[model samples]
Target: MFATRSEAGDRLAAELEGRGVEADVVLGIPRGALPVARPVADALEADLDVVVARKLGAPNNPELALGAVASDGSVWYNDALIDRLDVSDDYLEEIRAEEAQNAREKADRYRDSPGLPDLEGERVLVVDDGVATGATATACLRQVRAADADYVGLAVPVGSPQSVADLEAEADEVIALETPENFRAVGQFYREFGQVTDEEAIAYLEGLGGRS
Candidate 1:
């Protein structure tokens, strides 16, 4: 288990180097992932940025995700789960719209502007602290694709085997340090999975400008 997010980021960055992965930019899914992504950007010598996506929680169990929407309105829906849960289209649309706007506002706040980085023809690496359901990661991947990134990759310190397998289809390459067979939750793998405040997350992004 990683002692801290920074340690996980360092290991993930080392893994990417061993795999010969190179990126023009690294986009971290805030606010937990920013700490992890900072070390990755430093290691790869790439520009760091935020890729905002918010999970659309279930009506009854808000902790459970129905889907997710990115800042650019790119969405990833769990159709089977939604159908099984008998969620209505109207309800889904309502949550999707709300979450999309939330994601947009978050992206704007992190960037300090509405403008996103130019990713056309550039290799993009999308980093997250870890993947559980992978709903948000899917949305973020779609958003990166929408930006016309020449290559889109995913990097995480650890993940469930199923989630890692599923993400292989979405990203050009996926670098997961560990995929435990009996994974319960993302936090289970980390010794110190503390919450990252918005100010702390923003500072990581702001520091990237000096590197570029």
Candidate 2:
């Protein structure tokens, strides 16, 4: 288990370098990922930025994500979950619209702009604390692709075996330090998994603190 997100980032960065992976840009999903992405950007000698997305929760079960939507309105839906839940198109549209705005606001907070940076012809890597259902990661990957990135990849410290396999179809490359079949949640593998406030999260971008 990772002692801290910073430690996870260091190991993840080393793994990426060991594999000779090159990234022109490293985009972290904000709040939890900034701490993880900082070292990766420094190691790769790439620019670091935020890629924001919000999960669309199931009706009356806000903790259950049916999908996620990016700041640019790019979305990834879990058809299996939606189908099993028997969710209607009307409910999906309603929640997507609401969450899309939330994602844009979050992106604006991170970058002081509403959309992603120009990634055309750039090698883009999306970093997160870890993958669960991979709903948000997929949305951000689609957003990067829509921006015409030359290459898109995802790297994480740990993830569920199933989610890692599913994300293969979403990016050019996928790397995980650990993918246990018995994984339950991303927090299970972390020794210090605390909720990151916006101020602390933005500090990673400002270069104030991250290694802690």
Candidate 3:
């Protein structure tokens, strides 16, 4: 297991290099993935930025994600799960609008600006600390696609095998260091899985300047 998120980032960077993956830019999911994405962007000599997406949790069970909405209102839903839960269109629309605005606000906070990078025709690599259900990551991928990214890849330290498999259909490529069959959670794979503060996450992005 990795000692910390920074260590995980280092190893992930090396793995991407070893695989000869090239990216024009690296977009980290805010609050957790920025630290990991920083090193990868540095290693790849690519621009670093944030790609924000919020999970649309169930009505009663907020932890259970029905889908996710990105900053740009791009969405990815688990149709089978939503159908099984009998979630109404009105409810879905409500949550989507709420989460999309939340994502946009978070992205603005992280970037410290209202402007977003031009992603059209760029090779974008979306990074996260790890993937659990992949609902948010799927939304992030859809957002990147909506931005007209020529190629979109996902990079993570570890993830569940099933989640990785599901994400393969969303991303043009997936680079995960470990995909354990017995995966319980993303934190379980890290020895020091402390919460990353907003300040710290934004600092990583600030260090990248306007490269993105």
Candidate 4:
């Protein structure tokens, strides 16, 4: 198991460098992704920024992600799960609007300007501690694409094999240190998984949030 998010980030940076992966900017999904994205930005010599997406919880199960929606309205829905749950379209619409606002507020807290930077014609990488359902990542990638980034990708320390495979459709490239068959959750691969505070997460932005 990876020792910590920082260690995982370091290892992830190494893997990217070995494969000649490069980025003009690196964005970490706030709260948990900041620690991991810090090392990656330092290693890549890329500007550090934040991307925000909030998971739409399943009915009566807030922990379960039905999908995720980004601050800019970019979203991804787990059709299979929604169908299985028989979630109504009205509920989905309401929840998506609620979560989108939450994501925007989060991005605002971390960034002075809030939202994405000017990524048009630039290569961008989205870093996360790990992936479970990939709902958030998909939304984040869509947001990046909407910004007209020349290339958009995702990198993680570990992820569920199925989720990693599924994300291939969202990003130009998907990189993960591990995609174990036995993957139960993102925390299982991290030896030092802990919640990152908003204050702590903002520090990683390095005042490089976004440029006008």
Candidate 5:
């Protein structure tokens, strides 16, 4: 098992070598994804950037993510989750507006201009630590796709097999170190999994040569 995010990224980068993926850049979905993408960007010898997305939490139970919204208003929702939770369209719009604002704020804090990156003809490696329900990652993938990237690859150290399968339809390529069938949560595999603050995550990206 990898000792830390950097080590996990190093191993992941080695795995991504020469899959016809001429990496023009690496973008991490903060706050946890930034550290994981740093070493990969270094290994790929490409520019590093940051992508921010926020979970659109349920109105009553804010801990549960009904969907996610990226900085640019890109959203990916779990229809099943919303149905199960009985979330209404009006409530969803309210939550989406609040969460989208938070996402934009974080994006602003991380970059000079939090607007989507220029990916017209570039191949980007999007890194995240892991995926649980994949709602957030799916939203992120949509935002990246909207940028018109020449090629997009989704890379994570660990994710549920089903989550990986779900994301494959959204990305050109999907890479993961482990896809355990019984995966319950991403934190179950990490020993040092902790909350990453916006400031610290931005600092990590800045150290990796990240720019808006």
Candidate 6:
């Protein structure tokens, strides 16, 4: 296993090199993704940026993500989960509005623009620390697609096998370091699995020294 996020990102960048799909830019799913994406951007000699996605929580349990909303007002819902929870359509819309605003706020805090970078006719690699249900990743992918990227790829250090499969349908290419069968949570693979703060995320991006 990789020692840290930077190491994981470097290995992932090497994999991307092998595929011959050189990225024009690397987009991280903050705040957990920033550290990983920083190194990938450095390795690729490209710009590092954030693609903010706010979790759309269920009515009572705010931690339970029903879906995710992007900075550009794009929302992706877990239809199966919504059906299972019996969430009302009106309630979903309300939550989406709040989450969209939250994403925008976070984006503003992290960068001048929280939206996807210009991937027009460029290869774009979306990096996340890891994937769980991929609700947020789906939302991010939708935003990337909206930018009309010529190529779309996802690179993560580890992910649930099921989540990896789900993402493959959305991205043109998927490069994950490890896909464990007994996947529990993204944190299980990391020793330093702490939440990354907004300041830390922005500083990490700035330290990479270009396109920040």
lDDT digits (tens) for residues 140-199 of candidate 3: 999898889999999999999999999999999999999998899999988888888887
Candidate 2 contains a number of clashing pairs equal to: 0
Q: Mind sharing the TM-score for model 5?
A: 0.92
lDDT, candidate 6, at 10: 73
Best-to-worst ranking by TM-score:
2, 1, 4, 3, 6, 5
**Superposition TM-score, candidate 4 onto the true structure:** 0.95
Winning model by TM-score: 2
For lDDT, the strongest prediction is: 2
lDDT tens per residue, model 5, 1-212: 45666667777778877554558889899888877888788778878888778898887788788989988899988899899888899999988888889888878887787587798888988899888888888888888889999888899999999989999999999999999888998878777777777776767777732321
Candidate 5 residues lying further than 4 Å off, grouped into runs, are 18-20, 208-212
- Listed in order, each prediction's TM-score against the native is 0.96, 0.98, 0.95, 0.95, 0.92, 0.92
Off by over 4 Å in 4: 207-212
Error of 3 at 42 (Å): 0.6
Report residue 114 deviation for candidate 2 (angstroms): 2.3
Please list the residue runs of candidate 3 whose C-alpha ends up more than 4 Å from where it truly belongs after superposition. Answer: 208-212
* Per-residue C-alpha lDDT of model 6 across residues 1-212, encoded as one tens digit per residue: 66666667777778766776678878899888888898788778878888888889888898889999898888888899999999999999998998898888888887775456578987888999999988899889888888998888889999989989999998998889899998899878776676777778888889742222
| All models, RMSD in angstroms | 2.5, 0.8, 2.9, 3.6, 2.9, 2.6
Return whichever of 4 and 5 wins on TM-score. 4
Tens-digit lDDT track of model 2 for 1-212: 99999999999999999999999999999989989999999999999999989999999999999999998999999999999999999999999999999999888888865588989999999999999999999999999999999999999999989989999999999999999988999999999999888998889987776564
CA lDDT, every prediction? Answer: 0.91, 0.94, 0.90, 0.90, 0.83, 0.83
Worst 10 residues of 4 by lDDT: 203-212
Comparison by TM-score, 1 against 5, better one: 1
**How many pairs of residues collide in model 3?**
0
Global Cα lDDT for candidate 3: 0.90
